[model samples]
Target chain A: MMRLRELAHARTGDKGDISSIAVIAYDPGDFAFLAEHVTSAAVAAHFGATVRGPVERYELPGLGALNFVLHGALGGGVTRSLALDAHGKSLSSCLLEMELPDPQAPPAAP
Target chain B: MKTVRIGSGAGYSGDRIEPAVELAEHGGISYLCFECLAERTIALAQQARLADPDAGYDPLLSARMQAVLPVSVPRGIRIITNMGAANPRAAAAETARIARRLGFGGLKIAAITGDDVLDIIAAAPWKLMERPDETTLALGDRIISANAYLGVEAIVQALAADADIVITGRVADPALFMAPLVHEFGWDMEDWDSLGRATVVGHLLECAGQITGGYFADPGYKDVADLARLGFPLAEVRADGSATITKVAGSGGAVSLRSCTEQLLYEVHDPARYYQPDVIADFSAVRLAGDGPDRVAISGGRGAARTGMLKVSIGYRDSFVGEGQISYAGAGALARARLGIEIVRERLLLTGVRTSELRCDVIGVDALHRGPGTGAMEPAEARIRVTGRTDSLAEAVRIGNEVETLYTNGPAGGGGASKSAREVIGVVSTLIPEAKVTPRVSYQVT
Candidate 1:
């Protein structure tokens, strides 16, 4: 179960629109797996419709982790209509799904 | 019994490290926190293994808690401390043993670890965006030790478990005091205002009566009645987390605004955002009020969300350092000391043995008097300390032996100089990041 979200009129004056998020995964290891799979290109495609800036890496030294910083996303210039799943866990699921290898199976053992 | 009291028992010597027990048995306080770790304490403990295998553990640390732990277990008096350095589980097991020896059974002992992060620096894939010293770390080898300064939740759980003692690794100084306020008051984890009050209390009592006059010197208390019987601080916290700091009767030292302020600012920078594992307490919001006779009431503190990860302490055997000093007496002794330094330097250079670092100082000459003046120069001597870093002990020993040659070949005796200088064992300091560390906990019944 996963979901996406949309906030139209919630604006933070002069400070840029704040994006509050909660990233969840079933297995604790999957959180790390998703972070590893979601490269800059993958992150851009996930939020591609709206954000128009560079993806910077967040070095979380304390927690032994990293986060991708999505810069210049909310300034009113892209497709605002975004689709979401039911449980709001879609973002992390989408990132995790990218970790799955292509199903073509190397053109057969025959 | 006084309305408010805070402090450790001063008379208890070694093997009596339990400040909390003394405070409760005699001081009559509401809250108690025992602070045992220092910046280089863990590293020093590691090095002490070479001298004595059993020196790793502070034996006195356990004896302090023997008396009050049983009394506080049922009554719910909280005890928090960083007594779990290097080996927390062993300490926890020792506590349990002490409890059972006293016929206190079924005591729950929870050991909270995961604060040691020395290994994290090695496994880290990326570098920190910023460092305190701004020095670029080339590899993980730079770290010597890593221990996290965890919050009081683990101690709080141990308290909730009806444990006789809550043993923990190197938690923040304030967390030891804060945990009880959180557990007893049942304050919300995110409640900044309430947490701030607890934080303020922790700061006031962290140094054990530092709020009174342990560190600060007051004109009125220059000769505080009894120096030997000084009292430690006791914090009586309210439901809202506001606390009053005071000491027991018949104790030495005076608590005043000046003294409390001096203790508050000690070893802390940026009161606006003092950091811990849980919250960034704003010390600026706190107001200190002295109500006379060793009582300081603290209120109106605040906090912000924590911003960064906790840093750790690390150490390792990088090199050997040996220092030798010779005291020269009578006139021109300082000149002889200066000549001694030149003699050692040139000799080492000639022998093709360059030391990693060398420091030499001539005391009593320029120290008591100015430059080489017309006056009778006092008895002085040159002290030369040479330290070398090498994988081989033989090489370090060779450098130490080289010091004797300087005496005969160099300038003769000034005025009854000391025989030889002392050898200085080197203990290097290193910082550990929070990610690579964890504490291990265990227990046993005495």
Candidate 2:
């Protein structure tokens, strides 16, 4: 399986206590697989306790990207959070560690 | 039908100054925009104004003007900026004053104000969206400032009046880019699709160097060239609201599809509905194409009607943050640092110093990932950081004192000890009716 870092690059933004991370594919051809596999549930599970609220994913087919808004994720936002990366700037790189479907695998998998 | 080449000069208040000089010197552009204010910067500036009447604008305002004005003024490049922070009139006056010193006699500077609604907000029983329980009346003297995010109308009006440079208070970041597009292309304020497309261009150009590969480089995976002298971004916006993102040729960094895509998603929440004062831009339909090296063209942005209310950022006195750090090196550094943290924790409890929240982290060990710490291998050194949020300044100073005392009373070989206690400015959001605020542009001719 290829890591999400190989297929996509992401950036994170914070508003209040929420963090929005956007993942965009390097190649337009990989967009379909990323959009299908990288669901809100999957992203939510990846962050786990790092997020206190729900994770919502918005699809941008035109740009071959997915936007994930993680609520209650920034502790108390930038002004208050004691987190080293309080704005969740480094969190995007952590999300990039997500495993993706390997291109060399079988044509279809359940 | 003419295209406007606008270069982004400054992304934030303290961004590098040399890149702007590079843009002004070599980059051929009509207008250069600098975005300097953050959510809490104005509140801090308000505190500064309270201390000294003539010091509310950006501290580096004169320095940046000195660095950029000489090269830019003779080149006939107009400037737009929110470097005004808490005072646009003062910033505008200062820019004109600098122009006179630099012998630019024909420069006209405009200042946009009326974003400050502290009186109106204090009159009503308005509660901030973030703090539903706390009303404006309740905040009382702690309220430092409340400024609404203005749109592109005033900025466009300044440009229309032949102002060489436009300075504003608090404005929506994208609106800074959108104002030029509106003034150049004569695009209607109510045209959602075109406005939406223009907003995309503004958003792409808003953060100076991010779109040009300054913030996107990875060592082995995503390599970028000459990041030290990285060039800022420029957009060639057309009459139809479509634009091409490119930088000065032979400059550092690059403008590729990956860089464009990453910047497009920066600070953006929902792809379909990005709430701007002018319009709700829909970037879902936007497409990106690489025309040539260091060039990316973006189009197909859709927009909805403007929102009835505008967001206001209210700043108030929160709590105080106290921090202390000291490094330990050589044989038993990790163990010594751990002992130091434990002593401070016990000392605070013994002294009955109450903190609302406390965080202790071993810097080299597991501060970021919180994973295995120097497991099998014995490392050279480590640092312990003790941070706490206290209600009072005295209490905050004690938190640092407790840590600093560790150098003498607790740990061995603890060197480079430092301590600081600072006030925290908290920003809350509220919505004010669009009609409640009137953005007015006033200009001075030198």
Candidate 3:
């Protein structure tokens, strides 16, 4: 339900190590909620890494959405760890899986 | 049921029946496309960046979002569009955002980008060959927007990703809708004939409802009924990418040879060979037959092997320009407007500044006697508009200032400066051969 931009941020490390971590919101409105509650510091805390620089936010008018770009990470060998050939891998899918949360538990019946 | 296609423009307005939309709703259409790029669009996108650096995607897609998504999705009608002028990624994101906001969160959106190669033009290894039409291959300098008109590959990829919406930038207009159908139907990628049929469908519908009646024969054309509820065409290709074109029923517009052929020549430079990123579709073999008042059938499309290269789009710094306008009233205004143009041109030349392009037209006054012909004018009033381009704003300003002189003792207005000058920028497009284009695919999910 959430726009891709609103739920994500991506940045590459000094050696071109790409690391992105975002909290996928289920509802479009919930993106605003995540943006409000999930601070960059919180994200850095979750990843156990130092906040490299100010998170650069993007309000994509053309796309009618928002996104942020964060830098630096605790470790840099995510791609190398895969050890899979680049042509055969779908990194975007892997990254997306990491960013999105499993379905939340249903609320108790009233 | 037979296949039908329709094409429209970028940033569609649901306020009326866009031809493409109309065809899809009323006529039994199978495909819908909208070609929204022009020389001015890149400039508009650039200026939009000035307003908001993240404004590369076309705003017009918003118009198509609410209207088409609900109906098309429910009906299993697939849609493809190139409303992603400068940034397909942003366009796709915006589309998904709108869908989610509207409670249609299940829709998956795919954005195709990285076709822009503005940075590497200086060192690209391609020959930068010239076309037979005397258009030179873009040098590192002359390039304004060098976006490769991608074929249907990315669209196919999006469909493989199970995306509900696919947005692309500067794709060959026909490929917008063709790629998705071919992919969804599991059409063999190597089946050139099937690809050609899909390409034909895309071409027919690329101009939206033009395959309907927006730009068709007069008198019989139902401008109001047709105009009020335009249709977006839809194709129902199966595993072979061959399908029928039909709308959801009870929409406006009629699909016929008159309408379809009119759209065929809209921006056509060559009828024999229509160029696109995937393959060269020969329009000569395309056959159209009027099945009914609201149905047009198409088939017999052929395509040559695709050249192995991606077209690249590169935009860079270009000269600035501005245009000024003034309206003259009373007798002799038409003649005066012409003289006014001459005076301005002469003055600018005398000052030793040359403009890249200049245009002059006497609108109302010229319309008076000749009924739209350029001839000896019998007065009334004149409105003069002059467009001049220069690298310097100073030179542009001088050209704008001379208009007031024509109005004073020269043409008609009360002298002194009568119009305002605007700073303009020149935009030119060139194609980069495929060898220089490299796909920059990045993946992420949120």
Candidate 4:
């Protein structure tokens, strides 16, 4: 298994309760691999209870990036949230921990 | 081919001033833009205005103008900023005073106003964008400030009138950069495609150092040099709306395809439909290419017609939040931190603290990412933080008082306890008809 951080870098932005995180591939070749594995359902499940609303994903093939918008995040927005990181700036780091199958590894014997 | 070189000085309020000074002195630009307002800033500035009439502008306005005007004025680098916050007129007057003191006589400074739509919003029935069921009337007396996100028209007008510095309140962040492009290039207001490309440049340079690798630097993975002396960004925009993002020579930080790509999607949700006061910019088709050392060329940005609706940010008094933290170190630190959290949780319950919401976090262990699979190994030290939201200041104070008691009463070796209670100013958004709002510009000549 390989971590998402190895292939991509991410940044998070917050507007009210919604959080938008964009994960961009380091190489243009890895864009397809990231888009296949980093689905909205996968990210929604990854965040679990942290994001209270549905997750929407937007693809930018030209830029080799995937933008994920998580609704009802930030614990009621930055102004009211009691979280130590009010803007959820560090949430991008949390997203980098997502595990992906290593394409370089040989297939297991059947 | 005529080109305009615009430099982004300050990103947000309280951003570093030295980087901006560096841009003014050595950026070799025609216009310097400072985006210094955030979502909740105008509301807080309104509260301050209520207390004092002439004190709603950015506090650092004096220091920034004092630092940049002396250099910018002589070079004829026109200044554009949203540092006016809740009071652009006052901010412009302050800037004029600084210019005269610096002996730059006859400098024209413009103050753009009419963004304050408190009365218009209160008089009409507009539904809140986030909460569909609620209307502006529901907020009523709780509303502290209501400012519409104005577009580039007023700013363009100021620039046309030969204003050396333009100060404004609540203009769209991108408009601070886009206005200069529109004025210098004479791009039509209805030219959505060109305006869209301008918006891309504005958004990239809006955060100043972000494009120059300020928030980026991941060490081995993405190493940026001399971050301590990171330089601000500038755009060499052409009449065709294509631009190259670069910084001053020998400045710290880097401008490359990686940095530009990260910033291109930073804070952006839909790359196809980025809503701004001027246009609905489309960045999905945008492309970035590395030109040379510390330079990146960007193009292919598109835009469509605007929504004809203005987004107004409403600031209201929501509630009060009280927080307290205490550190636990040495052997069994994690265990003691957990114990401290549990003790404080029960203490708040036992004392009957009226809290609408509460959170308990161990700083090093799970303060940011809570739930399972977060922390792998126990640490030698941890800081336990307890925060609660309450309706009243008295109740909020008790929430922290309970955590402070943990320093002596609950866990052994708990030290450096700190507590604070403050009122929470909540922000919400609603839309108003574009025709209902009008932007006006007033000039102050030094």
Best-performing candidate as measured by lDDT: 4
The sequence of per-residue lDDT tens digits that candidate 4 reaches over residues A1-110 is 99999999988888888899999899889999999999999998888899999999999988899999999989988888999998989988889899989968888889
Worst 10 residues of 1 chain B by lDDT: B366-375
DockQ of each: 0.01, 0.57, 0.01, 0.83
Put down candidate 1 lDDT per residue, B146-191, tens digits, no spaces.
4566777677777666654566667877787788778777878888
- Decoy 3 TM-score against native: 0.65
Residues B1-446 of candidate 2: C-alpha lDDT, one tens digit per residue:
68889899988899988788888888889999999898889999878877876678988889899999999998999899999888899898888899899888989999999999888777787777866787776777778889999999999999999998999999999988899889988888899999999889988988888889877898887899998889998888889999999998988999999899988988888888999999999988889999898999998999999887899988889889888888899998888988999999999999988899998877766555342222345558888889898989999999889889887898899988889998989888899899999998888988
Using all chains and alpha carbons, the TM-scores for the candidates as numbered come to 0.64, 0.94, 0.65, 0.99
The segments of candidate 2 whose C-alpha lies over 4 angstroms from its true place after superposition are A99-110, B132-134, B330-335, B369-380
lDDT of 4 by residue, B1-446 (tens): 89899999999899998887788789889999999999999999998998999989999999999988878888899999999999999999999888888999999999999999999977877899888899878887999899999999999999999988999999999999999999988999999999999999999999988889888999889999998999999999988899999999989999989889888988888889999988999999999998899999999999999999999999999999999999999989989998998998888889889788999898999999875586667888999999999999988998888889986798899999999999999999998888999999999898
Alpha-carbon shift of residue B40 in model 1 (angstroms): 3.0
Q: Which model is ahead, 2 or 4, in terms of lDDT?
A: 4
TM-score, B chain alone, candidates in order? 0.77, 0.96, 0.78, 0.98
| Chain A vs. native, model 3, TM-score | 0.39
Least lDDT summed over 10 consecutive residues: which range in candidate 3 chain B?
A: B365-374
Model 3 agreement with the true structure over B210-306: per-residue lDDT tens digits: 5555544234222325555655455545444443454435666666543554444333333445566777665555565655556666666777777
RMSD per candidate (Å) reads 21.5, 2.3, 25.0, 1.0
Best by TM-score: 4
Interface RMSD of 4: 1.0
lDDT of each: 0.52, 0.87, 0.52, 0.92
